[model samples]
Target: MPNRYLGRRIGKYRVTRLLGTGACSWVYEAVDQDLEIPVALKILRPEFAGQEQAETRFRREAATAARLRHPNIVYVRDVGQVDGTAFVAMELHPLTLGRRLALVGSLPETECVRLGIGIAAALAVAHASRVIHRDIKPDNILLSQSGDAVVADFGLARALPSGSFPSDTNTVEGTPHYFSPEQARGRELDHRSDLYSLGATLYRAATGRLPFEGDDWYTIARAHVETPPSSPRAHAPALTPQFEALLLRLLAKDPADRVPSAVALVDALAALPSAPAHAATLPRLGSRTVEAFRPQVPGRFHRLLTAAVFGLVAVLAGWMAWGRTSSGSSAAPSPRPTSIDSTGNPTARGGAASGSGIPLASSGPPRDSTRDTTRHRPIPAPVRRVRLDLSAPDSAQLYVDNRLVAVGRWRGEVPFAPRLTVRAVVPDAPATCHTALHDTVLTRVTPGQRLVIDLPVRGCAVVRYRVEPRDARVSFLSLDGGNTLETRADSAVSFSLPTGRYLMRISAPRCITFSDTIVVRTSGNASPLPRKLFCS
Candidate 1:
């Protein structure tokens, strides 16, 4: 990822802040300094930009996407190299289908079907051009301010020759939730694969959940390959039989069994009754056409906060009421003593004096002769949160058990793990203190314990970074912080770091990564270690 690109120009586009990140590139909202208009720019990662296969695919994305002219497709404006990085500029939508889904976990059946038809129309145009979008997740779909759905991001599109299977095999592309069984197997794919992915997306839109839920990606991928998806109706019981039938047919493992083409899929959606009191009319991907368009995702924070406030109020009220009763009773001077007897019951001190001048029984029920001996119950220990406050050299990063949990002075409940290892490192330069820009300390901390590590620096080192292939993507991983960009092979990147032993890992795509202990000297700026890393 680029550390700083704002105010930089790639052709006519001037970079601003990041819009969002994706698997292939980092997208930024930019302004065309020439046209004085806003546009979205996607910069290819250095690793993917240099590889021959990746570059060819990137070029195909630009060319194939540019060939299309449709209302439902994101229009590509320009594509070129900018400052050693490859980028594509496209019309800015400002909103995405993913963001909409985040707000609306699910959609009404009619709304879902309408969206499906709109997307299918776009896919029909792409498939007609012999291009198959390998990645068709909801994030790739953009929404105009008017709510019209526009399919975007053709970065993974594959061009197919007439009447032939593409040579790509043993390559799996697409989101895990939408991957077809054939894709999970790394088999050749055609336009039909996009239909299956569309079905998966539709399933989520209708049910608010994926067909398969797993703890991790590997398990989900395995389920996609080995297990049949749960019936969509299982999650969305309101779905009509006709709707469920078409969805199941689209999701069939065999491509031949799916809808013949995107055109057919659109036709099927159009055939369904889109307007009726029972069927519920849903405007086809139009602007938030009606005020009834409400998000399905429920916000829990407000409700929880209200409940906690009420709970605290109730507890305080009860405690105050109890104190008032105790005070009133004390003033009245009850005959019974406040002290408890051996049986754990309140008894009178003066031979259990009572109002009638006769010894009275205990306040509660009488003890049974057959009752067992009373055993003292040890008080239960209360579970409490252990606060963490860590300290290191200024800009030092911290990690617990290989997971970067804190930086600088951080306070948090101790992580739940046996033999917690607390490590600290200071980066030669401060980017993010979440990773290992410096060395580390492996201290074993027990769960439910607090600790403060004042890590002292041994002293500073002026180290220079040199990588080959000026365009080759490289990054310095801080054991104490998150990943940050390093100086390109052309730029002589050097930093004055706190003197301490540190482990810095340098990695690039299409090349083996180099990892080792780099010790900085205790005295003044040490001689530049003549170590040059090469990507081979």
Candidate 2:
């Protein structure tokens, strides 16, 4: 069905434009006529609306999300059913962090830290209320105009249950790349699972890359269960050792090894010196504090004078000098030391002297020697030629400073003779593209110098299959007796198998046994397989 954005108004909100669509719902930028505010309206997909169980789950999500009133959490304004369609009204943000990250390649260290802290703070609030945000990823984080971060998509979140799964059955309800080891193995999940997802999101934000990458969903999901993540510091060496340590702790296979709560993680982050806005422009350690300097009078005089006498004299002289300099040269340097002091502030004596001197006269008359040396001078031209080569495993859409320049396929070259920003994005995984401005004066791109860029696809194939009766469970058994694969109820039985053969089996109480020997080729479609049967 073509996406219909008609006169579907939920509660007092009037649907305007279609923002986006997900598997189960369609989101619209709508106006709340009663409240006279813009809100995001999420309506259940038409097919899912008829399912009572799905509707119940949707209602529960709204209730849980509505209870969370955090600065970093997207506010849910209203929830109701209109003309048999279930919809929710929520605070609307301009864009998602995922889109921004895609546009900029990767966020600066300071921005990543700030966003991470905000997300952690929001998660802490949810955890306090016994809610677990099972789906935590870059796409779920929204960015406000002021750069504040807010967590969205609480529809998949669930209240903490009292019991744990004993068998190979669990509801896998998160993006594969960000899923925790426990979540991948169909085991019990807690706040730690969310922490793992946060770490994955932070890893991408810091490095412009995902911790685990593969051609399909199973491969990436299995990496979460079996493979160790590449160090974030390896990709972005400028990241602090403390943050690297935090990433490792969050990615620990054992849930107990991770931070106990989101609040604790936030506290730990708050304790660390905030990541600098620009790596090249980091401030000195003591740059913000005022230094206490003792007056350096002739040694015996300094010791003999009382503290009150010295302080009073220094303050009076400082005020008189400050007034004199304030009206002096417009070109004179401000009354601040060029270098930081031991206490992180400028030395009082040095700072007081900067603006005290008379402005130096220009060295001789302003030179007009250009007229005398015109014959020897070289005229500079505006245009500069720069060779640009774009190469990737597959096709890429190339952009120069946000403007689409060309679309390249396979390993090829594009000679961009003009000095401009160059960015390449795979249409599917726009987030993985590399974006950089070419300044010929600062840097030169030579011919035969290939710029190799990797365009990350979703990196995993999500094969979703529903086992009938709700109670029936599925598992992938290796005919070679290697490892048993647990399956999630809401998700397909996934495994990171290469182009090879494997045996799968399904089991449940009083159900006919099911097993199959299937050859999974790399180039085949990603759709879920038809239900298979096994002899009891």
Candidate 3:
């Protein structure tokens, strides 16, 4: 079926093709006729136009997000309504962070840092405006052609009326997998909630897994409220200590434990590269006990002892090299305070030689046996064995390294191979509604470390609902009858559905049946479904 909106003109923008469809609205690749430039036009689904509060909130918050005017935020071009359709126009990007992650599981530590900095900076701007982006997930973060990370879809953002930080809302919103603990419990929220969400997003980017997962939204939400997230390093062992520390701090269950504000978050991210490389717990290998050492600058006492020992060894070695020629070569000058450069070269600093003023060798004294011994040691390879727990949709074909491993849900151990590839494909459906849906994780594992790889028949998107007449009954049936939902009235409910068209019908004893079709896609949040159902 073709999109009816394509080739249609709304306000000054002409819809080109459907970019994506979500619970609340449909985003289209469009051109601004006035400016003759491309833009992404998000139009409220016809069924939701009657939702005045949702519409007002969408426009109000979108305008607030547009006013942010930050380099890392998606630039909004215009906001208005034509006839009965309300739409927002924004700068179009080639892809989203979610899409990139699907194509390539996890990103390099350096790249994650770069993207994190931009996202934090943008959050800083939004926070300054007293605007809270209630939803900060992978889908809402866009990636420009220039590779810059830009935050999109402030559809869930709300600007607080007062200057006091925390605000109260009766509804529990946001994607389940990325919800903050407070958000999960429907408690008062502040900027810290957004920080926690950002942490979850980065956790996924760095580990190729959600900080918490469950069979459903309620389960995932419960996990956020009660479970301690697994350390990011447990999944991606190659992450730097600094990166892991920052992520852990961001993911702290208590809001107070998170970075104070986006400004502080910016500082934390900026310091990642220069932060000292402290002790890091390396992932366990097969059955070998892991070994780790804290690499720190020695204390004054230790430094003095180390210098005395190295000085004695160096003097002896030099004396051995030139003992015959120079009879009275004054004792080799005491070692000076040394500093290690970026390239690992020890450079002399502080005071010069004390006892032997005789012009000393500039080539630095002869190396000692201790120095050569420690520098030439080789690191051992991890033992070749692994354990895995694979979860996929029923009847889905599971493959390891392109070889058939199992069909449907299978939990079993597999042998370790360099560059392990695990994939799951459903017989007829797409893995995810929008993307090709097969999942791939490129990670090194150990027999003691169990890797849980989950593949789905199709990825689900969230749509919020609110029905009127507390007694009214609301339900949804997909065009193919594969998905059916029965939801409550007058409250926020998360309706998870795969990509497809569904018929929505609402009924009350004395009211006429209100029926409409909803298109569910991989982006956007549609909420408070139809503020009130018309009664006849």
Candidate 4:
């Protein structure tokens, strides 16, 4: 059920409806009766009201945002409480950048630069306030109907000491893909950390893809700490060298190498070589603006395709070289950090085969040197493009070995790799409801070959229910009298089905058979079927 106070007044504002909810707080669209203005009222969740840490973090967001009032920053308007439930009211924004991206596959270059400048301007003010937005992903940025973007959500921001800034590396607090290498290692962080995340956001805006792809958090986090991403041109060809250079520098594995500060980044972006009022003419991929964000789960071995990968990351390392710039200085390639290189580490031997389940480095440990020394190691093979035609519903995204390659019915070239794994997801479906509806393939693509695959979508509904006895035998059947699927009923069950009426019957030890009929609806709007039907 939605939280109470949706229509009730809290302090001077009347909560109209929920804007969004997170693990810590709930944001509501409200009207400030005293001021006669629409405001975003962010309230600490009632469930977490008594927790000291949650309360501190909630209040800390207000304390931090209140001090950084700039045009591009979503500043707090009021801080008050009602009946021991504290809330902060700020300027209302209709949508978030992450949501906006989902609606449009990627932003035009001009719009991307404009948003970048706005976010950098906001960060400059926050940096001046001695605060660093540790979490600076698309989800935290809000956009207005006027095409203006504002940086919001300071819940992960931390206050810095005067003249010195360092962060504890033990607890990695930010999103894995956008997190800096230092942040991934739980090391000290300065303002540059936010810039690195900005580059990630820009990369997505320019390319409609994430800089890194992984099945789980640890794999992505490890890549942030170790692997270096390819240039922006590798994803979006129309982006200028100057623009790509700045983004690469911002994403430099070393914080010292990133754009010095938000102010510097704004200046650099302003002077971009292709600083036209619009983007260049080029073919863009994808069907809609979207973020391929896979929520971070605790780093555990994913059982989904355990038989899939062994020599996972042997990319044909052909990095796009940065040529001479307007300033006549060519961009230099950033050397891979020695600290992250596991080639010489004692633990590098067959660490991936140990069943740790964590994603191993793309390049596994080197083969035996003595045996290779006897014969010349043949030149490394070039990445061969294999043409593939894939079909799916609109707004569906396809990934090859975690790298987003296509959307919808796409015919494109894919880098040749053995044991290639393709996974497709429909953005509109809820995670639980569409779990079985995903399309996945495990095979090898022959170079210079063309292939087609009709991505099968498992159209189903998830009905969650519980039984009186944990060990009750349950049988699931389709109303069309299709074959039944039987299993023991545990705490709760969630199943997807085709559009139809379905029946579930549970038979306990000595009790009579209990049953319920559920109606499966459309694909989108996958609200979980609340398990309220208790069978006794």
Candidate 5:
């Protein structure tokens, strides 16, 4: 038909069927010929060929994930390139959370909470290693047949550096629906970003929708930065308040305000009680009595059928006894079991039930296709107001157009002013005053806004310095003795002060001698600003 990829062999595995496809890759169920085990193979698309950066990132993700060994995390078995296609082999699971959600509308509270705990535990491990899984959504979480959860997709993860690095430039590389506020604004990100994404994923899994839904990326990005998400209980009222609070903390606009770590998140989830109800009971698939399509059996076949019936009866007896002991003798009875036959009709307690009326068992996994189309109403606008204040140091007199406006320390909350210029000078330091003379200038201030300006003494200068270095061995000293700066190679440093005469010193190993002194005046603009030194 359409170039079917079934029945192909790659490496030591034979591909059986295509599991799914995404923007850049495809996954298939493949069998290992030697071990006789099933594995899921993820292959990169041809479009990514010749892209070195993409290839490097993919390899890094695989390598990092391979190092993680946690019960709630998916296991990565092998990674290799076969015929120019990069592939990752992993444990093959029955269904994903996405498929389950789609088939069953939304999961029960107990199941959602249990799944959240498992995911949070896995994220704790990833975050401990300084790895952030930028993408956390329903499609990336798989559910086992026994009701266990495992997180997948480390393809978009990256390790954070102490300071800044070239890798940080790609900060906005995640899906918009789950990106954090900092990520939405294209700013540096930390592990808190992943927590925010996890919160969004949990919100969707529990409510069957996204917290901040939009028609396009721009709207969603704006929502992430400026709008508060709806409370989780709004959609799922049965959710515990503590659980809701945890989700809100995860969705905090500022990274500093989010839960400090993934481990803490696990603790929070662990503290919550189990869900109130059991999972929806699915109809057994073998109970249906179907019409025999083959002819009557001979004497030997009859004997075989009798043996099969006895074996089935023995197995049922054991199963019932175990259930009675575990659930108490008076446990609620299960709904009469039913099953779908080849003719599409369900068979159970009576005649064949109407095919259209019977509910299908929620056997498939969750899906992410639900779209919210509601429009928001506009908000009323507000009024405006503005103010400004200016000041200068001793030996400095303010001047405007060859006339003195005020002497030292001139300050006031004045009305709207645009382009107010002042210059200062002193007889002792003529060269210093030459530059400081034009240092004081005020720009326009809008109504309802506040502006403050500080001017330095005419014959003296004060400089603000920050020592941002690649190595932490350097130390910064100011002649005034009030301010000091010290930092390691990977630390950010800052210094601030008034215009004045002072000495400065910097120290490091195997580097040029660093010491300087200068008399700075308040007359000119600050030049040759402190530089960020990168030491090898």
Candidate 6:
């Protein structure tokens, strides 16, 4: 598809060029006519405009960012839906932490800690607001020209009530390599979950490699839950023992074993001496007493702000030169794959299918899964456990082998069996919309694999037709291979079928056959007036 919004105006912003794309929206560099400043405008794709779930997510991201005002969080200037096109305008940055890592393999220990403190402070404020940024990765952290890191892309963020953390077991939601153990297990998450992911991101920044790697998502997710990460000093031998111990504690499998909160994380990272430390004084791994003997860590925010520009002068200068060569690329580096499901196929942006026959599109290709021959070794267990993921309507009930198992948005482990019967039921559904319950037989069981099952609930729509002849016969055929419906011996006929596009055909004994394509919608928007067909 050619770029339609390029060189055109959406509201007051004139889109100059495409910046990057995500699962459901496109980021474009647009000049705001009112403010006369260049901003990054994220707009929903045309195919997903009318979808309730997609539109809600697009708006939620804007609403979530608008609530937080911090130096390290991306600033949202405006949000609007003009002519059914929803978009958000945000401050534009020139570089991202991901792009920087790609250019320079890894940063020095001191520089890495400086950037970590800034991001931890941002997370501290966000967690105080009771908002959890479910997806925190290198791609989501943007860097300004002055080397300041700003967290962006909150499409996966959920605003929970105070002291409430819900278990999102339906699917694993973050980048595979950076998942926290609790997140990988689909357990209840709190601020500590974000802390673990930050540790993983910094692990990559310090060592130039992921803490865990595998050929597939399940392999990596299992690694996060079961395996312990190698010491950071193993990969980058130059790293100080103190820094390595901090990284290991952050990657603790149990959230309780990790840093208590973002505030504590900021303090801990700030207390690290700028140079290498002796092994005798290093904090022992998994020891909660490490904070007791540590020196009083001064407020890091002021020091980072005042000294970062000078400490990173060489980095900022190199970034400026790279920006000039790359034609001024925007900071948004194709938002992380929040919609990646267990099947390895990316779903719609909002964690559910949009109900459109057209496959929901994503802006970037799925991340490549590499085989980790060095660290991955098969573990033998007596019983085989496999995770089951089902996509059904809200309140729908799922059964396995005639026993009730779970309800909406459920992911749980079941013992491996060669063949098992699966069934789904939607209670209180209208008689016209209830789909028959059938036993779905699943085969080819494997250990440590995730299975995704989609149960479609068909709904009915009525179409009234009127032919010129009083007794003309009319028929409707579903293009999607549904059963054909017809009515005869009446001028006015009403046909009820599943909601979708259909081919309408009308015929009489003495008139030319008439054929046209019609649509059956699931809402009140379906036309009430009878369709008038002229047969000359």
Best by TM-score: 2
In candidate 6, clashing pairs total: 1
Give the runs in model 6 whose Cα sits over 4 Å from its true position.
166-171, 275-536
The TM-score measured for candidate 4 stands at: 0.52
lDDT of 5 at 459: 43
lDDT of 4 by residue, 31-87 (tens): 899879899899888778788999888888998888876777887998877877789
List, residue by residue over 1-536, the lDDT tens digit for candidate 5: 10123334567876555677877777887778889998888877667866898688778867877886776788888899876768888888858888888887677667777787678777777765567888888888888767778888888887766443223754578889988888888887777888898888888887777889988999999999999999888998878787788888888998888987665565456545553222111111000101021133236774596468557767997999999898864765444455545443444545444332334344565321232112222333443433435476565555442234465655444434455554543323322223334345656646656656666443434344544444534444546543454545345443333355455565565555456775444453355446454355
Clashing pairs in 2: 216-460, 216-461, 217-460, 217-461, 286-344, 513-534, 514-534
RMSD of 1: 18.2
Angstrom error of the Cα, residue 301, model 4: value is 55
Ranked by lDDT, the better of candidates 1 and 3 is: 3
Clashes of each: 14, 7, 2, 14, 34, 1
Displacement of residue 161 (Cα, Å) in model 6 is 1.1
Q: Per-residue lDDT for 380-458 in model 6, tens only?
A: 4468878888767565566665445676556788888877667665532333443523347888877888888886644
Across 347-428, the per-residue lDDT of candidate 2 in tens digits comes to 2344354543322233466423333222334334344334445443244454443334455533444444333444444332
Tell me how far the alpha carbon of residue 276 in candidate 4 is from the true structure, in angstroms, after superposition.
Answer: 6.3
Which structure among the candidates has the greatest lDDT?
Answer: 6
lDDT scores of the candidates, listed in order: 0.67, 0.64, 0.72, 0.69, 0.64, 0.73
TM-scores for the candidates: 0.52, 0.53, 0.52, 0.52, 0.50, 0.52
lDDT of 1 at 138: 83
Error of 3 at 458 (Å): 34
Q: Compute the lDDT for candidate 5.
A: 0.64
Candidate 2 lands at a TM-score of: 0.53
